[model samples]
Target chain A: MIESVHEVLTRSALVSVAATLVAAVIGIGLGTALALARIPGKQLMTAVVNTGMAVPTVVIGLAVALLLWRSGPLGHLDLMYTVHGMVLAQVLIATPLITGITLAAMRLLPSALPDQLRALGANRAQLVLRMWIEARIPLLAAAMAGFGKAISEVGAVTIVGGNIHGHTQVMTTAIVERVGRGDFNSALLYGAVLLALAFAVNGLLASVRHRGASWERN
Target chain B: MGAELSLRQVRQVRAGREVLRIDALDIGPGEHMSVLGPNGAGKTTLLRLLVGVDRPTSGTVTLDGVSTARRGVEVRRRVAYATQQPGLLSTSVRRNVELPLRWRKVPRRERARLVAEALDRLRVAHLADRPAQTLSGGEQQRVNLARALAIDPEVLLLDEPAAGLDAQTRSAFFADLEQALADRATTVVQVSHRAEEALRFADRVVVLVEGSVHQVGAPEALHHRPADASVAALVGYDNLVSATVRTDGEVLVGGAPTGLLHRGPAGAATVAVFAGGVLLADAHGPGLPVRVARVIPGPGHHVLALEGAVSLLAHLPMRVQAPLTGDVVRVVFDPVLSVVLPDSPADPTPGVLDGVELAYPSRVPS
Candidate 1:
């Protein structure tokens, strides 16, 4: 029992950590691009991103499953019912949340920054890098929000991972399985561990974001 | 070295409206030029075009006679534009000043030297290690100016660089800024709606109204011989009264002849007078009848409003006991100082008074 629970905890951490890393990278990049690019259909893209933020995670899971199912266009990859499939589904569920927060943070910046940087002779790459640096603290906050969504998400991961014992079982799926049987205590332990992990990650992020960010210390 | 900047028949259109139309404008090599105008008068737009950030809707803008249309981003390297808001990074002041140097990929040693010089020049060297976000608005603006100068730009455009500073701070900043650029061979194009700053700092001034150049000349010419009511108000004319030019070429106020003479064809003309041009006249003497309605005190002067056919605001040199309120006194303008221009047709759009009220009060803290 202890060994299985340990596997569940490790698998859950792996899935959330991998998904958060991938989503954060893509989301921050895409969000910054959206904020800075003045191309056509920018408003339309922003509207679509906002709508994507409201998409249900289960719907994402179903969509991904369909795409990766046998005879589906992406079926050649055979990501279904595998850990890779869970990561893919989790990424889809978390990217929008991460992206929405990052976009909002970048948008809140004073509009003159990009222009001023250009005046100072910054090339395109320099402008983007400077903007990212100025938005560092808030982007970290975006990461925290993304992690929260990725770790707590159940619908997408369960639908894709299949909750198979000793294989795809993560903490949340194990807890669900335990509840379906007569193992409430085990279910409670998994719940407690998930909560603790979330607190740990968020606390670390908060310290970096807010501590000594006062005027004097920058 | 210094670059000559000019606009040849340039026009800017926005939302299908021609917002700026300039036939010809020249900023001589190493000259300081200021453009004064009301809000939404396209002052910022003109600067943007000069810096080559935006192409003109028509015609050409040139730097040193080379057209800016095809200069590309490379043109931006030779010029620096700073807006009213001192947009500084959230990093150290030294870093903010080091930005231009960094973008040019200057060697680390040279970058440090240039950054230090810029900081010292702007008089913000003491705050070099402090976070730029922590500095006061004036300090941040100084750093912004320092960053602009770090590139040794040939043409510099500043939009209200000294804006939001107190009188003392503004003067001090300008003194430092001018000294910094005095030997740099840089041609500066600045936009300042403040009459005194433009008059004091710029060798040439352009007054813009409704996206068209109203008048361009020495600051004194714009101040003393404004082209019309709009230009008059922009040049700090406290009183603009429309009057008829009599057959004898004498302008009349309140249907009676005043001593002010005009050289234009006899018809309608608008009289423009500054506060210092108003002189106290004998009640029964050659001036018009007026009652002092209020006296507002300034640092070295007093503003007195007179009620006549139209209310007039005038600046009087500081006196121990100027005329009191409710005193009916005859006041006459210094004919040599006043201006008479052909009365322009009443504008279909909003008047310049509304523009003045809209621009100043919101910016200046009462």
Candidate 2:
């Protein structure tokens, strides 16, 4: 039983990590772009992002399930019931969270900063670079939230990945499976392992953020 | 290498209202010109136009005959603006000053050299290694100015850099600023409502009123001969009274001959007597009769608010025996020092004040 728990735990950890890693890259980039663009309907876009942040994991799961269901539009990719399908769902769920937080943080910056930069001969690209450096701490928080959201979410991954044992099951889905099988002991063990994994990732992020280091300062 | 900045027929309309209108104004190469005005006078708007950070609603802001709009990138490289608030990054002062040079893509060797020179010129070299966020208001402003100078800009635009500093710090800061500016042939255009500092620093001054030029002259000339009563009050003329011009070129205040002369046509005019322009004398002959309403002591002079048919403010040198409040004495007006500003028929007299019951409310004390 303990050996089976170990295999399940490892499998779950791999899925969660894969989902989080892909989500971070896409979310941060899309979020930063959304915050910087000055197009019309910005308020409407912001409202949509806010609503997306509140979207249920189950809704995302069902949507991805339909899209990759062999008869669906993206069925040719054969990603349904696969770890990649689970990652795509997680990315969708986390991108708006990042965009909303990043937009708020960027707006909090002093209004005089951009004007002063232009007067000093900085162009658009340079202004964006400077803004990133200046708002790095908040941007890091956005990344942290995205990772947390992707890892802790269950319904979406469970639906898209089908919770197949030793194949596509992540930590969240594994715990749900253990409980379903009436295996109380295994469920508790999986839950503990999930907590430790989350702690490690966030701890690493916190250390980097607080240290800020000479490189970021420069 | 200084740039000649000019504004021609510049009219700025904000929110469907004309906020600024300049027919023609020019700043010579390497000249220090200060735009002096009260609040809402569009002084900042003018500075922003010169730096190419903002475009005028209509008309051209040109540098060396090239319109700022046509050569924005090139013009921005030549001008550096130091705003009122110090927009410093939370980094070392050295890094803060180096950012502009970096933005301009100056070579690493030259960047370091220029940054160090600017920091030293602003007298902030000792704080170079310190984080810019930890500096005081004055120190931060110094660093802010150093960043502007790092590019070796030909034109420097300052928006009240010394505004938040204490008197001693402000004077000291400008002394350092002057010394630093003397090092380079930079044309400085500063916007200041503080007359004393503007007078001390600028070679030429443009007095703006409600987004229009009221007067443009040297500090001394503007102080001595304001364009009108409004301009006179701005330059610190404490006692403004209504007077009429005489055919003999004399001014009459309350039907009393002032012995002052103006080339104005014989009609109604406004008289501006600065507190320092009038005095109380113990001469053998009688002067104007006045009762002292208040006497405020100063470092070298005592400012007396005298009460008569009309209230007069006089600043006289400290006497061995100073006159007490409510004491009646004779006051003398220095015709050479006072100014006679012609009043248009449409403009109301600033002299006809309301409710000046501070001296004599209803009846004079016997």
Candidate 3:
């Protein structure tokens, strides 16, 4: 039971790390673009992103599964039930969360930053980069919260990732499978590990928030 | 090199309201021009238009004959604008000062030197490593000024740079600014509510009233001969009285007549006299009957409120022995220093003290 728990925990951690890295890259890029773009229908776009944040992981998983199945348009790529499919599902869920939070954070930034940058002769690209830097810590906090939410989610990946041994099985799905099979010991161990990961992410967030708050107070 | 800035009939309409309207304004090379106006007088809007941050609805703003709209990017590189509230990054003061140079892609060595020089000039070198948010209001303002000066732009637009500064700090800041402008041939255009500062620092002063250029001239001229009552109020004329223009060319204030020359209308007029222009007398002098109302002490002078048939204020040297409040006294006016306005026909009996006009013309050399 102990060895099985260790194996499941290891695989879940690996998948979680991969998903978070992919999500961060895609989420931050798209989030920044959405936040800064001054296009028509921007409010609608923001509404869509906000709606995406409230979507259940299970719904996203089912939607992705339908799109990647043999009968679907992109079935030719044969990505169904693969680890990459699960990664895509997690990225989809995390992207909007990061984007929404980032947009909100940018909005909260003092209105003076952009004007000051422009007055200093900074072009659009330079202004965007400077504003991002000015808003870095908050952005990081938003991204991390999205990463935490993505890693801890189970319903979406379990349905689409098809928990295969030594392949698609991740910690959350494996723990559920273990519990269903009456392997209480292994399930308990996996649960503990998952809890630890969540704790660490939260701890990091708190520390960052404390530093940012003090910086603001000063 | 210094560049001349000119605005030709610039007008801005935002949200269906005219935010700024300026006729022809010509700022010479290396000249320091001060913009004086009350809040909401479109001073900031005008500055933004000049710096190309906001496009004018009509007309044009040019730097050295180059149209601002046609060369906004190039023009921005030559103009630096500092807002009233200095906008600093969430980073250290050093980083804030280094931003403009970094945007221009200055070499690391040059950027470092420039940042150091700017910090030193603002007397905030010790705060280089501290986060900008840690500074006091005055410190933050100086940092903002330093950041704007980092690029050494040819034209600097400052919006109330000394608003939150102490007297000593403000003097020091202005002294450093003067030195920097003299050395670099930079043209400064500052917006200020402090009339005295405007008069002392600016070669040319422009007054704005309700989105229009009310007056423009040398600081002294604006002070002495305000274009209207509004201009007189702006330049700190404290004695504004509602008087009737009598037929004999003298103005009657509260039934007592003073030898103030008037023409045109006999209905009503506004008599504006600078506090410095009113002279205090023990008894009835050549002016009019007055009673001492209040004696308020000020920085360099004492403000005496004399209650005659018309109330007036006299600003005299602080060392002079002055009558206390309620003391009977008389006052005299210098006709050369007084401005008489014909009553607006629309409101013939304009209430004695309803609206005070504080917008005035700029002071110009006589």
Candidate 4:
């Protein structure tokens, strides 16, 4: 039991780390694009992003698993039941969270910033970059929250990656597996680690928000 | 770095509603022009169109003989427009000032020197390193001005730059602006609601009403000889009376001849009497009888509200004695002081005036 617990801990840590990096890259990129796009159906796109934020992890896992299955159209890449598959599922769930939160943050910036930039002769690209940098801290907090959410989710990884030993197992899945196998101590240890990670992410976000508010007052 | 600006019949329509309609305007190089108007008179919109921040629905805004609509970027580089509310990037003041130079691809050494000079000119050098979000309103406005000046554009467009500033700060800002203009061949087109500021600094004043230019002339002409009733009201003519042309061509006020008459043909018109133009004297003086209603002290004069069948106000100097309420008095005004406007058919209310037409051209013949 002790050996199995150690193996699961190591595998879960690796999967969490890999999934977090992938999710951050895709989520933050798409999130920013969605925030700045001036498409005709922008409000509808925003609504879809907001709805994605509330979707259960199991739903994302099932949808992504079905799409990557051997009989599915995208099965040519053969990503099912692997670490890449799990990362894909996590990014799918996390991207909307990042995009929605980023949109909200950009909305909070003063309305005059864009006009002012244009009046200063800033090209469209410069305006976008400057506005993004101005909104960086809040966007970072949002991306971090998405990272934590993806790292802590169990159902998505369990279904899409099959929670394979030494391959796709992640923190939440590993904790559930440990509990099922009567290794209560291992489950408790993993739970404690997850709680600590969540606390750290939330603490960082709180500090950023407080700092931003102070900057506004001055 | 002065550029000539000419707007020929520029009209801007948004969502089927006309936002700005300027028939014609010509601002020469090194000229300082002020636009005075009430709220929603399209002052900001006109400024935006002139700077290429907005495109007109029809007509043209040309800078130095180049059409801004066709040459957007080139025109923008030549004009610096500052909005009424200061807009700053969510970055350091230095970075905000460095933006225009960065856009022009200016070298780092030159950019730094220009930014420093602009900040120093606006007296906000101490705030160069601080984030713009940390600055006060006045400081932010100064920083905005610094950023606009950093590029040293030929034309400067200011929209209500001194609206929220204190009197002392406003005066200082105007003085700094004057010095800056003197140092460079910069042409300025500013929009302001403050009459005193416009009178003090503007070489010419243009009055806009309801999205159209009502009058344009030298500052003193607009102040003393407003083109119409709207211009008169905007220039601080607070005492307006609706009078009928009696048979003898004299204007009768409350059933008595006041010796004020229109220079044009006799007809219904609204006569505008500036508060300063109405003189108050003791009851024995040779003028129309009036009853003193109230005396209100102003910045440099005492405003006396006189009552009869019609109430009038006289703004006398501070040394003038205040008359008690209900005390009989006499009021007189120079016949030239009153501006009579032809009555409009839309407004038939006996004592309420709508539009007033001018009899003489207000501009001095060149």
Report, to 2 decimal places, the DockQ of model 2.
Answer: 0.58
Native contacts retained per candidate?
Answer: 0.55, 0.65, 0.59, 0.37
Per-candidate DockQ values are 0.42, 0.58, 0.53, 0.43
Clash number for each model: 0, 0, 11, 1
User: Tens-digit lDDT track for model 1 on A1-218?
Assistant: 77877788888889888998999998888898899887788788788878877899889989988998888889999888888899998888778877888898888899877877776677789888888877888888878877788778888888888888888888888888889997999899889988998888888877877752653254
RMSD of 3: 5.6
- Tens digit of lDDT per residue, candidate 4, span B1-366? 689999998999988999889889999998889998889999998888888877899999999999877777767877898888887876689988998889879899999999999999999999988989778888888888888888998999999987799988888888887776678889999997767776677889999988999889998788656777788788887777766665455665666555455445456666677776666543553456788888888988888888885788877777666678778876654444556655643221112111112111131121
> What TM-score should be assigned to candidate 1?
0.90
Q: List the residue pairs that clash in candidate 4.
A: A218-B134
Q: Candidate 1 docking category?
A: acceptable
Q: Candidate 2 clash total?
A: 0
For model 3 the local lDDT of residue B256 reads 63
lDDT comparing candidate 1 with the true structure: 0.80
Task: Return the TM-score for candidate 4, rounded to 2 decimals.
Answer: 0.88
* Candidate 2 lDDT: 0.80
After superposition, which runs of candidate 4 have C-alpha atoms over 4 Å from their true positions? A1-37, A197-218, B65-74, B246-249, B281-288, B335-337, B344-366
Q: Global lDDT of each model? A: 0.80, 0.80, 0.78, 0.77
In the range A48-119, model 4's lDDT, one tens digit per residue, is 888999999899999998999999877988999988888788888878887787788777878767767777
DockQ for candidate 3: 0.53
DockQ of 4: 0.43
What value does DockQ give for candidate 1?
A: 0.42
